[model samples]
Target: MTRPLLDVRDLRVTFHIRREGDLPWTQPRELHAVGGVDFSLAPGETLGVVGESGCGKSTLARALIGLVPAEGQAEWIDGKDLIGLSPRQMMKYRNDIQMVFQDPLASLNPRMTVGQIIAEPLTTHHPGLKRAEVKERVKAMMEKVGLLPNQINRYPHEFSGGQCQRIGIARALIVEPKLIICDEPVSALDVSIQAQVINLLIRLQRELGLALIFIAHDLSVVKHISDRVMVLYLGRVMEIASSDDLYAAPQHPYTQALLSAVPVPDPAHDMAASVVPLAGDLPSPLAPPSGCVFRTRCPRATERCAAEVPVLSGAGHQTACHFPGPLTEAEIAFARRTEAA
Candidate 1:
């Protein structure tokens, strides 16, 4: 096997929030945005992160790139821990890790021309390079990401949403980062545009040999572009497995429900019959369930699930569920008929 490019363990990101009208002395509530997520990425591999809106998919990505204050180890293959790095300290590794944010237009500065935006990273990292060299590289990157060299002088507002995203891709790639964390890169695009961006990313990964952490709510897109898919609930991983394995035989109840919600393209397929209904809203992270964060909504959850936390175990396909395996037929039926408590 090729050596892993990045290995992360026990990664956690917590935020302290003080509500309105609270006394100065009142203790702030701790919101665990990411609770011990662990994963590894090989060179040129894509790991898709899928979950509900509040799950820590974005947090995990931010934690990896030092955008958020995180705890635990995110060891780069070069023998550096990414967590807790100061801004100056992180500058050294900025070229090795880059992020493409969800809002393409917002991520790009409207005041700056496309050339300047794409060339910004190069200027930051390779400050000694002459302006001419930076412009040539920027134009080359723009062409690579499907933008015309002549349009480099145009501002972000001049382009359509999809074109703006291509510009964002160019900026991220301009630095030639080894790993690119795409936080819902395609979610904001039109459905047709989403496919274009996704294909662009896949091609870029292939040509550039880049590893990607693709976080999105669209499972079908994730399945298409990812070698492995990880399912998160609240702030913890529910299942992590190969795209084919996890989608084919989802072991965790939460994973099963999530997969079931993916719309089947076939017109004749009974979408309603295939769905595994989940109960209740996601529990607030401030006071998550003690044992299993997913237990409150999982039909298969039992007494043991509520008392003891399940460790993510298994060789090839890891799942953090006390009863890890495919949901039985009866359980699916029960979940479908059950209403929120």
Candidate 2:
């Protein structure tokens, strides 16, 4: 197999949770924000990460870009481990990987002009670039992201949500990063604007050959842009498969439930179609369930699910379930019947 541009292996992130009135000041409580996760992204490919809220998708993205402290291996480009990099080395590595945060209004600096915001990365990374050159580069980037060059002088507040996100994308792309970790980029925008932003991402990716890890809760939104999809639950990956295979025939029970919830467009056909809501709320990450993180909500879960954790195994498609497979015809018929009544 060809070497991928980005390789993440057993990536885990933990945070210290302190109560208002805890016992000893020296003692600290640990919360596992991200459980072990493994995935890869080829050069110019997009891997969509989908899950419910607080499922650690954003935390994983932050860890990949080194914005947050993480344990486990995140090897980028030529097998360089991000976890071991020093502050100075990490500073230099920042130019190669960037992130587009969820909230555009909060991600941008209110005080900085659009030009300065975009040029800041270049000026810091490539100090040799003169003032005129920096300005020219920023203008070019603004244009690349569909923003007018004149708007370079404006602040983020002057633009709409979509326009502000464009500025954010310009800032990330201006550095010419090899990989971009997009954390729910369009969830904040209206449904109409979401399509526009998604389309813009697809166009830019094809043109620039940018490797992407798009994190989103909406499975259908990511389906349009991603090559492969990874379904996560309670900080653990439930399934990983090609977009064609996963959506057409989901394996894991959790994945099945998620896909079942997406409303089909046509009402006349598949008139019995309806969403299947998962049984219960996602368990707390601080103290995740004993074995399978999704067992509490998975319909097919058994005693084995509560005892031994299932390891991901498959050739092209992997699912972390002992009895993972596509739903049978009878099962589909039953689900439709249940939804109707």
lDDT scores of the candidates, listed in order: 0.92, 0.86
lDDT of 2 by residue, 14-34 (tens): 999888888775567778889
lDDT computed for candidate 2: 0.86
Residue-level lDDT of model 1, residues 145-207, one tens digit each, is: 899999989999999999999999999999899999999999999999999999999999999
Clash count per candidate: 0, 0
Highest TM-score scorer: 1
Show where candidate 1 strays beyond 4 Å.
none
lDDT minimum window of 10 residues, candidate 1: 332-341
Q: Where does model 2 exceed 4 Å of error?
A: 25-27, 269-273, 328-341
Q: Estimate the Cα RMSD of every predicted model relative to the unseen true structure.
A: 1.1, 2.4
Clash pairs (backbone) in predicted model 1: none
